[model samples]
Target: METQAAETVERVQPHLAESLPVPVRVGKGVRRLALRVALVVEAAGGGVAAHIADLVRELRVRGGVEIHLVIPVGVRFDGVIIGDDVLAQCDTVHRLPMLRAVGRADTIAFARLFRCLHKISPDIVHSHSSKAGALARLCFGPWKQVYTPHAVYTLNPYLSRGQRRFYGLVEGVLGRFRSDRIIAVSVDEAEHLQRVLRIPAARIETIFNGVKKQPLLTAAEARSALGLPHDAVVIGFVGRLDFQKGVDRLVRVAQNILDRGLGNVIFAVMGPGDFTVASGVSADATPNNVRVLGALSQARTYFSAFDIFSLPSRYEGFPYVLLEAMAANVPIVSTRVSGAAELITAEHVGVVVPNEDDVTIFADTIAVLAQEPLTRERMSRNCERAIESFSATTMIERTVNLYNRLLKEHR
Candidate 1:
């Protein structure tokens, strides 16, 4: 991997802007023919990857820009992934070693990565999520950097107020001093970043995340794939079974629904994470009423099996799962978080219950949706309509336009 990565990196001619590590500025009679963009991430398989995947596809098609994709593999950090299909869009791929956001090892590893990036000298450096966002800013902030904390850790509901405040302090210091631009995935998230990070409002740009528009699976087809009976009222959920996702809360709600003999409702939770005990059985151990399927590789297609989609996340940025549910035309029931998912209520495509520990409200909401076929149909259609605003094409166009505007300002 080292030898191959070295060869790939060697292919690029460092065409740095007058700003040194920043992209070259077109001055006088010079016409800038191409811009160099580097997208760095520590995300493996999740919404971050989905966002990067869609953005990379759109970027390559737009042309006039050379993209160098850096993904840190062979380590535990959640970062970018470059599958063969995703590689087709990138001009170069760098697979370096990455450590999770702790310990001195992270400093050592990313220091090496910083040198590699220095060699490439990207004009535009965009970092995704928490770890990469911080590392990239430290490495390239003096040049040109865009940091997108797909979801800020400080805003996670699982964290105590003090812990959240500490994280907010760290992020606040970094955002104000390091980032050239901060891309907020949702409007609510943008406001929170400004409030917590004290980042200038001008530095933040809210580009609600987007998903690919694919033909959705039929209810019968999705049910067949999941081996569900025709009478089952399926409530589908896709996300990590982590503290952030609040799968424990979801399990308790499922148990309550089952105990009440609420129609033939089946809870299908899909995604990977550490397990926790709920009622009697472990959520990862597979409870009776809840079918906890480990992470599905093609989850993007499985959203259609549900009568309603649910997310009980403790906190979130803009979740791609929400976008997938909309594209699949499934109504949503989610806990209110500071992220863009709150738009569900504004758009009338889904129900948003206030964040609380009790499962009674979530169970009752699910029961209500199960009983009202007309309401479900109306919300589902609204979800389909909502997909247009968050399409892949729209996100790409906005992002590229941002790139152009940023270039002009720096130039």
Candidate 2:
């Protein structure tokens, strides 16, 4: 009966190739079958959404797999919505309501997720981001569970001691009993899981998030399009204008540079949200040298407009923007976040400052980089070479290989 069912699936989905095999226990022998995967994500926007999209696109091309997607209903972040084209790649799409914080509503989210997983009957259930990773793991099931926390909440330095402890406890418990595997997008994240959360080292795998190369504008062309002074040194930022993204820090850095009378330096932020509220400064009070661009589509393509790319993130798990910045041949100025050391191989490539540094430090780093055109040019060339190692193709292939190995062991 199982063999017949597999054959039927192959016949109906000819594009699947149906050649790759996963092992399943049957009587005294093992049987080969197509691996079925269900992906669940609650916070389904930004880099998390991009990661899932890349995985689905590549998995479909590889064939021998059935893919299902589960996301919150009407899930949109800062005007960024998941496209219908990405949803079309999945065999099934399930929607549930989920909140970013722990609350009474999680009961409903968990129940709906449980029902969705039962209907899909996937061989492996993969959950992305913190919210969905926590909820999906709590539901008991025979399917092997894989989790990827884009950035664990406990990693946030601003979290209260009590809040950090509580979240860490939840993650520690889940990591031990619920998860079959936990993928860390950077070595720093994997080490944190082991050292801080006490998650076993053996259960963790580091898989860097990848990005597709895109055509970028020249500095002059991008400046013209953005309505900025062509001769000025533009420092660019691209991320959510929220605490985690350190928009306040970005504002402070910009103010510091301007206060020093760096009249030729300017700042452009490309993402959705209110800078006035985030930076605790009224619209009229904001610095004249800083421009807040709310939600520009394909923000990475405009990277060349800036002499330097600034990432003031409080924390991250291999940011897609950083990779995009490299692909765009833009030198980076980043806080010592998860993936900085791994990607920014040398001082010639970019500068990474300590995360605890004052805004002045960040401002000065950008300031100094701006003056050295030759150094920036060398950094751009190195970025072009470094980015090739983190392509979407390599990331996808490693992920599929992980799945195959896990399924084989499960039998």
Candidate 3:
């Protein structure tokens, strides 16, 4: 097995070597010419998948590039297809069966990718997420690589400090070989990458994620569907029930609200994650006036049920839920993490507080917002106004412009 693996590496080495030289720009209108680009990701899910889909759609509309999505093997995206509508706009969709394992999978994927890069000879390769970014950069040889971490790997609470440092070190080293630029979804994230990973500021660019405006459902309809009394003051949270989401904080805040005997106030947590006891919430445990809806796939439906949306995440790389909530004209109350602080203009859009702060403060803020209908309405209007800049069209244009500038400089 060792010998076979060695032989495979040897066979792929030449291909990697031959592909080291960058492709020459041939045409006078290279920018206008549809350049072949590969967008690689390890596993497609949630916000990352949404971003990829949006990027592909915009790239198609722009008409200057052909996108080929190269994803990991055995990664199934049921009911999601890059259909003829997308395919008709650009080039071919090539699916690579590259496994993701520690050593064996890495070697095999690198070998496969080395050969694929040689064959496709793409003008650019853009990678998303940690695994894909690392693997794509390692196997890229001399490809002009653009990496967007989506959310930096080091931000994960699951990693030990040493592990986080190691990952950052790896990213820094790889930055020299593979990355021409790193796109951070928020300035906070870019700063984190620079500080933790030692990636230079010059290599990092901050681009806030954008969403399309959604129509707000009537308060009556929203309240009725949520089983909330028409006159009840609704305070809502939307996101996964994961630790990083700080759902426990939200639950504790809910408990406090209920304990205070706040009249006509309902606390709802929309979205899903494991609500096991270990996660600080019981799947079966009941808290008075607390509604926990696990794993909401259709977020818009739940967004309609919220009078105010709160995100108590410990950290984030510009959450999509925030954008969606704003689009829905729901006032927000979020922790001062990532772009949330910058996005929430005090008394204009919503309130921003420190992470893991007192549950009373959180509960109090919600209670205050609940009591002041005019204030809530003002924040709601401000959120709607601020969302104009975050529209999908705006984000796509900015992203494409960046791509164009990068390609132009390199070409």
Cα lDDT tens digits, model 2, 1-411, are 653232112112335324423456999996644788988888888888778877877787777777888877553422233566566667766767778878998997888788778877888999998899999999788888899998877888888989998999999999988998999999999999999999999889888888878788877887888888988988999887888888888888988888888989899988877777777788887899998777777676688898899999889988888888888888999999998888875424688887864877788898899888999999999988887788888998888788888889889
TM-score of each model, paired residue for residue:
0.88, 0.89, 0.82
What are the C-alpha RMSDs, in order, of all predicted structures?
5.1, 5.7, 7.3
lDDT tens digits, residue span 1-411, model 1: 755563234223244222122233666554443678888887645788788888777777676777787776653323333355666567677766665555686786577669767876888898887877777888853357888888877777667888777788778988898877898988878988898679899889988888877766677887788777668889887887676777778888887888888748998878767555322355355547677666666777777789899888878888888888888888989998755345688778878887888978988999899889899999988887888888899988888788888888888
Candidate 2: worst 10 consecutive residues by lDDT? 3-12
Across residues 131-186, which tens digit of lDDT does each residue of candidate 3 receive? 78887887645457888887787766668878877887888887755688888998
Q: Where is model 1 more than 4 Å wrong at Cα?
A: 1-33, 75-82, 160-162, 275-280, 283-287, 340-342
What do the candidate models score in CA lDDT, each in turn?
0.76, 0.82, 0.71
Which numbered prediction scores highest in TM-score against the true structure? Answer: 2
The segments of candidate 2 whose C-alpha lies over 4 angstroms from its true place after superposition are 1-33, 75-81, 218-221, 346-348
Q: Stretches of candidate 3 above 4 Å error?
A: 1-33, 72-90, 94-104, 115-119, 156-158, 215-217, 220-229
> lDDT ranking from best to worst?
2, 1, 3
Clashes of each: 8, 1, 2
